[model samples]
Target: MEGCRNSKDYMMDVAGRVFVLGVGIDNVNLGEALKRIQEYVENGTAGLVVTANPEIVMLARKSPDFKAYLDNALMVTADGIGILIGARLLGRPIKQRVTGIDLTTALFEQAAAKKYKFYFVGAKPGVAEAAAENIRKAYPGIEIIGIQHGYFNDDSKIIDDIKIKKPDILLAALGMGKQEKWIEERVKPAGVPVSIGVGGSFDVFSGEAKRAPKWIQDAGIEWLYRLIRQPSRFWRMLQLPKFLGAIILSRLFSGK
Candidate 1:
């Protein structure tokens, strides 16, 4: 019960919140976001950290269940350039984009130095293992207590294992919706101090997928890079324009 902070109480501290299309995105930079997570770990508070992009925000707009999850999440950082643009249009500019991969990689550095335990669950078979191995190499002393592929039919075993291992942080890369839902419904309840939906971070870490270059990411065109790299994401990329359009419409109507 101590880990489960009430959603109302969490949202009451509105100093860093920017509402975009009815979803609250924290206006913290990457360092601030990491500091909050470190606080969670130190306080032994169970929390769901959502790295929400335009796609995820749009999905939350369309789905009540998803929207509820976002509303209740302990922290929702702006994970996409579209989110920052939308916040600006809404006259509530966010500080920066705190992406899942960047946050996770930063956390690894802290975990390595602080000796925090980790449990990684998601990505394709062998992918999480590969990422774990690479992580071990990169962060020599970091403790990864458990690893599991996301291809399971039932998550009971995985949940049980996580409960037992009780890692300080749990990273689930089961894509967007599923990963968030899993972290909220399963990992948080299992009492993990910090749980995050990492999307394809494992794939990136495993070298199965390459992230966009620094310039592309800084230019806020990483979406374009991703689309160019994986043409199959054309449909997903379409969400960007839709998200921007909605923001413009909202601003026009509300005179924000």
Candidate 2:
């Protein structure tokens, strides 16, 4: 996403948008979102797409700069169940919850058909490489031109390499703030047309982690399943209430 645009009028017809905490999140279906992404890729649009979750939103609250960064993204999609509930509470409904992993998977499928060049960055030692290998096996003709792990100390070298590769799209799996900031500060300047922060998706695609069952996903309790598996996340889950409280106050005051 390339910042808030006057072109939102044209986009709203396909998938309406709603702003939460000054960050605009697109309310489009997967197909419509992909169409918009393809348009960006074809036209050489320089932007990042943020699959925003409640935690990401809360992070934005602490960093006004990061909030502005997200507001400037080419597009932001509702990637967490909490975001969906917040929208409903505000009286504007997002059509669906589009998780980052799902979006990344869909993009891989499209890349196979469209022959889009892709670059993978972030994750631990050999994680990104494994993800790329799995993707190649699953999607024949996908052009993953480069792979880089997340441990590098120098971003300039990484950006320089990506500049040489000239990938059409880049997926950075460097957690949340690090990933988004990396895309905004490094990938965009390197001239990657489309970049997204795909937190932990590499782990799942690389077979290092597993997604919840369809029923669990559909029920919108994937967070619970994740908690059951990784109880260490309980501290992060504390932010959920704060997120909801902010949404409630926003509705009361702004009448959204």
Candidate 3:
């Protein structure tokens, strides 16, 4: 709502349920968020995440439910440097970008420590298997109850599978807003304590797509690097200018 700068008022929306957080914040870092997420998982709780890409924040401004869902989310962190900049401009800057992918890795580590089981859901073809195998290799002894690719139509089907496994953590790599909506409607109400929408992170983690180097990520140029690496991103890149305009207009007119 308040230009995506308010972390205390975090959350974004979709058609299904309340997202616990929003973008355009820059206060929480991966370390702090890892702690918060650990607290939630250890206690059996749930939340949502929207990367603070300018386009998403801009979309949050235009979409009523998106803004409200984000506002109601339990945690929202700045996932992009642009959002950090926006928050600074608004004088309520968050401290760092909390990337969903990085958070997933941290969560896996924490789950390993706690012996928590995780469910890998969504993504096409070999992505899910690769991600699961990669995780198993990276973090030994963490239980992965089950794995399913993002190819189903009936949401109930996936819900049934997840209900059976009852993993402590569920990571949906269905990409962007769609992933949020899917989990909100199908996963959250089914009693999933913690479910997050990870956009294409599975691919990168699984080595399907090459992630940037450490320096590239630190420079906050990962996005640009991604766009350059993935030509398919050209269409997605088109969303930026539109999102940017929406943010400015929302600020000027007080769009909620």
Best by TM-score: 1
Which digits, one per residue and each the tens of the lDDT, describe model 2 over residues 191-210?
A: 88899999999999899999
What lDDT score belongs to each candidate, Candidate 1 first? 0.86, 0.84, 0.69
Output the TM-score of candidate 1: 0.94
**What is the C-alpha lDDT profile of model 1 across 4-31, one tens digit per residue?**
1222212323467877877888889999
TM, every model: 0.94, 0.92, 0.83
* CA RMSD of each candidate after superposition: 5.4, 4.5, 5.2
**CA shift of 161, model 3, Å:** 2.1
Q: After superposition, how far is residue 227 of candidate 3 from its true place, in Å?
A: 1.5
Alpha-carbon runs more than 4 Å astray in model 3: 1-26, 241-256
**Where does the lowest 10-residue lDDT sum fall in candidate 1?**
1-10
In candidate 3, what are the lDDT values of residues 87-125, reduced to their tens digit?
A: 554435466777888788887887767777888888887
Which runs in model 1 stand beyond 4 Å of their true positions? 1-13
> Could you tell me the lDDT of residue 172 within candidate 1?
91
- Count of steric clashes across candidates, in order: 0, 7, 17
